[model samples]
Target chain A: MNPKDTSTGTLSYEQAGVNYDLIDPLKVAAQRAAAATGANLAAHGFTEVPASRGESAYVVDVGPFYLASIVECLGTKTLVADDMQKLTGKSYYDSIAQDTIAMAVNDLITVGATPLVVQAYWSAGGSDWFGDAQRSQALVAGWKRACDTCGVAWGGGETPALAGIVEAGRIDLAASCTGLVNPKERLSVGDKLAAGDAIVLLASSGIHANGLSLARKLVERLPQGYLTKLPDGTTYGEALLAPTVLYSPVTEALYKAGITPHYCANITGHGWRKLLRHPATLTYRIDKVPPVTPVLRFMQEHAKQDDREAYSTLNMGAGFALFVRAQDAQRTVEVAQAAGVAALVAGRVEAGPKQLLIEPLGIRFGDDDLQLR
Target chain B: MNPKDTSTGTLSYEQAGVNYDLIDPLKVAAQRAAAATGANLAAHGFTEVPASRGESAYVVDVGPFYLASIVECLGTKTLVADDMQKLTGKSYYDSIAQDTIAMAVNDLITVGATPLVVQAYWSAGGSDWFGDAQRSQALVAGWKRACDTCGVAWGGGETPALAGIVEAGRIDLAASCTGLVNPKERLSVGDKLAAGDAIVLLASSGIHANGLSLARKLVERLPQGYLTKLPDGTTYGEALLAPTVLYSPVTEALYKAGITPHYCANITGHGWRKLLRHPATLTYRIDKVPPVTPVLRFMQEHAKQDDREAYSTLNMGAGFALFVRAQDAQRTVEVAQAAGVAALVAGRVEAGPKQLLIEPLGIRFGDDDLQLR
Candidate 1:
């Protein structure tokens, strides 16, 4: 028996090598330390928006506007792309590049800031990685395409060849986005979040850059590895490599429709539990949920996880959540649809406790599940 | 007998695994692709500063002020810190943290922008690395201290535990800084670069986070590795771990003293070749150079590199350079001195073909050596 095996003998994120117990404290310490440096922004005629400290993105209050910034990385998904490329002599960097950009731009829009510029950080084990013209050019092309899709400049970036620290024949990818919230009114830090708000969840495409470490772990148990096909007839690697859905257009449409979400959460890392990411003492009640993508269903069944484990550890179906007044739910969905994205009015926010309740799956996660601050 | 060895049978940067010939074309391709996305910024009421495309930082015209941003990483330096920590049983993360911040913020200041917020990207191979409270806490303390030193907010960052791609028991460090250049006139993208400017050189503590891969390679040939004592009575590891000088103070002092440099170069990756960073057809003649630090001297002697190779591949001594009008050069030096940094009027710019001339060492580097765009 595996020493780290749980009582259920099933996979867990910690078993997959990501232990929140050891990682969250450092995050907390960083936030506490970061909190003390807010005063330093004053020298540049800007002030830290105190409410944005633990939010998805960092926001600063400039005189006529606000700027939100985030630095995010596509964790381990590139490894999957690399493995798949070896199986079928094709370059997957274009799709992975879109995934990396979506990972950052999606988080930036949570604070109602439209992304303005994105700087890339590509650390390769050696300079030889760029020798493949197809892969490298695809990455360049896909980066530009993603920036065009998000309407942000593909700003200059750093391409460092770190040999010893990064493993040979591998590349680590990340992006930093700086956004603009003009007129200052678009800044949303959850101060306006309240009860009786409708929760509209935007659909996710496949796994969508989160839970990849677990998914990649699950592949080892499969007979054919990444070639295993889901029930929908698509190979597992192809499904997981589907470029993430860009949500900027939907957020921009909601703004154009004069419907500002009281709070927005990019459902990443913590799966559906991210619905309660606003840090308010309110309960998120989900009555209806989107259909799980085939790739995610395959992961759920193969991992032998129950509803609680599946919903808490994977996106399940939703990739983003928007909390707005109950009356605007249908219009929010309409705007998302018009913007070429699928969204649904799935839940409501209620006063009482800080927890997430998925009624259809009979799953609930308490506040202790996430400790970003 | 080594097939890849140079004629002199001494180590070179390419032999150490960092090959610019293989890397520069990808950068050129990326710039070509990124240049296409510059128009995207116009939708958000901002425009890309066209001249800043290939500069140290990406600058955007935000109506009243300009925002310059850069994402830089401390390449392979952390591996040295990790190695030293094992030998000394002490945490060098505090110093490495400052080095990471300086790498990004120093690049930001090169555009005449005052850093307002810095966001970190810390990617560890596994979550267990954070279990070391001393090292992790030291990183937090040092990050906050660096922010305090630069007078910039330590904005929130992403701490992703990348298991498969990054090597186990190791971490990758990078930071992104967004700065503000107020009054528009302070924005320096080398538009005013002329033939009659004087070059001011600033002293570096040691190797300020550049050419670390080569330095780490040299340690492998040493009998005692990082524990080897230098002539200065300090271990090789200790000298390399010394915190890089935060140059924001010198830039701020220059701004206060009404000394707007025609161009500024943060001497990093290309070593002294970075002194000719600005894309101008002018010759930079250096009559005097800064005193080489002891650690650098040791690396030079052991690596068996001559003056030309050493200066081109390492900082040697000067970490930053300012090209100001001849009349303002002395005042700039005095301002830097008042800010507690040593500076010297080391060179002059002349109307000639693009190149760098080290008069004292009889070294000359033509324009073909550096190709950023």
Candidate 2:
């Protein structure tokens, strides 16, 4: 496998003056506050699947089926599209649509559910933002492609023309997805995750829809702006705009293959440190760190972010991770590879504290770094 | 019942710089382009329920069950929160949160699907905006109340600090909800909607969540800004921010009471004209239009809008409408009243060209006004 295809990822780096430390606590408080109302579901013949509340998506226990729903945003990634369209007269809306859907479906697959319907919420600062038919068509086309890749249907969505709330000329993109886990046996919420599980890493295409606020901030320091060239001669913006890898294929492949992973994690905002997302107290020891690609390397260099920050913030190649029994580890890798995603047995779950250790990089993230609970 | 609670309203009047003529075409193009992709739903063992698209929500046919999903936005409404915080020492985040969730869940109920999970997407132009703990807690509390009122779990959400993409110091709030329609019997898509069906109009509490852009534009003309008093002597912003009625309870009551409506509409954006949202060829006729109340009266009088514009642009008095068989008309009103929401049989359906006629007001909306299809 290509070393650049080996993957690890996180979302904590500060960029554009947005502080994760400040914003995260508000989310934590909101989650805790919402817990009281979770009981309201019981009145309507539904039950809360305990502990699924804080995960990337919330899982609901219906009588005959389990439903998983997630609401996610592409952040400021589409601002890159807005800028690039002005700079190159090229509409990247299609890929921007794909990026938004990828952000939703990718996180959903981690829970072992197959997405059934995907909805789009595209709010432009001005109504004229959609005046460009090329941009509109590209966006709709790209969104459809992403849904097709994920094997889900494009449900419906809202396109609000918010005049004063959004910034002029720029559009904010977000989406929500609903997936079903039938027979209840396919549900994986880390309860089955145990020490000694094999950790398989899946490769990211490149900075899949997180840390754009940081990346946008870093671009201002570049002499060429988005036109700066990387080692491969591709423009900085083009490289950054690479469509996010659809992790759904790998998850679907494994589910069909009957290889049950104890847990899965999408290495987005938190980078490689996300490998330790399991609730069980175990150490994620990484024996091999994926080689950093030029797009990520350029961003790290321009931003003066070190190995720890880059690997923990930019995917550094690893996009998603799966934890499975030792017996199923190789087959899981085979399934991902068969589905055209890079896969490797990068580490093992060890009986220890909840920490993520990158031995080759000589860096570690303590349990305190991940406080989603 | 109080005159203010006599019920039935719509938001159709034209408002500040937002032209549905220009915006609706883009939506039509996008929806048309997206229709090609909806066929992909069959890949996941699910099929798109025919003609469910272009309505308030999308309904998917899952063998033994039908799932309805909706993505709705609280357009520029949160800006009201941002302004109110500056005017008053108090934060209205709780009610803002309730309003956001109500927008999504209310639309879902129109299709007879009980909300199972609701996920929120809050995008701030900057991260520091959430630094206000009071604002965050208020938002969390209000969201919980809305969920509790509607009887659904606060599933999960994505809070993105999108610097430069949204207006600084403001947040763009939207949400998507997934609902379940089981036994396949409770579904109300207007298929059974016969001409002569009684039109039950449900009363809106106040401004609800629509037409804020126009209201905000009119507010600039006020010397007192948010503190400007209406005839009732309440501040303009406070009255406008009245909690939107959580319509889920009414839909749930009608479902449990064995009262099935042929169609339902959440009176927002397009106002009462949304009553014609059903694909069937039918006209909705209004005999007793609900009386306009204080908050709406204040805005219309101040904006110099006429009855046609007021009823069309804002909910005036009617908030939601239900199309039921003539025999079930009174029973539907009883069901809504029992659920704590004021409702009345305000009108009836007839065999004619698609249109909405308010005889008491001598105003009619032709089919050309609404172009969702």
lDDT, candidate 2, at B226: 82
Query: For this target, which candidate reaches the highest TM-score against the unseen true structure?
Result: 1
- Which ten residues in a row are the worst by lDDT in model 2 chain B? B1-10
User: What lDDT does candidate 1 reach at residue A64?
Assistant: 73
TM-score, chain B, each candidate: 0.97, 0.94
* Chain A only TM-scores, each candidate in turn: 0.97, 0.94
Estimated TM-score per prediction?
A: 0.97, 0.94
Poorly placed runs, candidate 2 (over 4 Å) = A1-12, B1-15
Model 2 chain A weakest 10-residue run by lDDT: A1-10
Native contacts recovered by candidate 1, as a share?
A: 0.88
Real A-B contacts recovered, model 2: 0.83
Which runs in model 1 stand beyond 4 Å of their true positions? A1-8, B1-8
Q: Can you write out model 1's per-residue Cα lDDT over B303-345, one digit (the tens) per residue?
A: 8999999999888888899999999999999998888888999
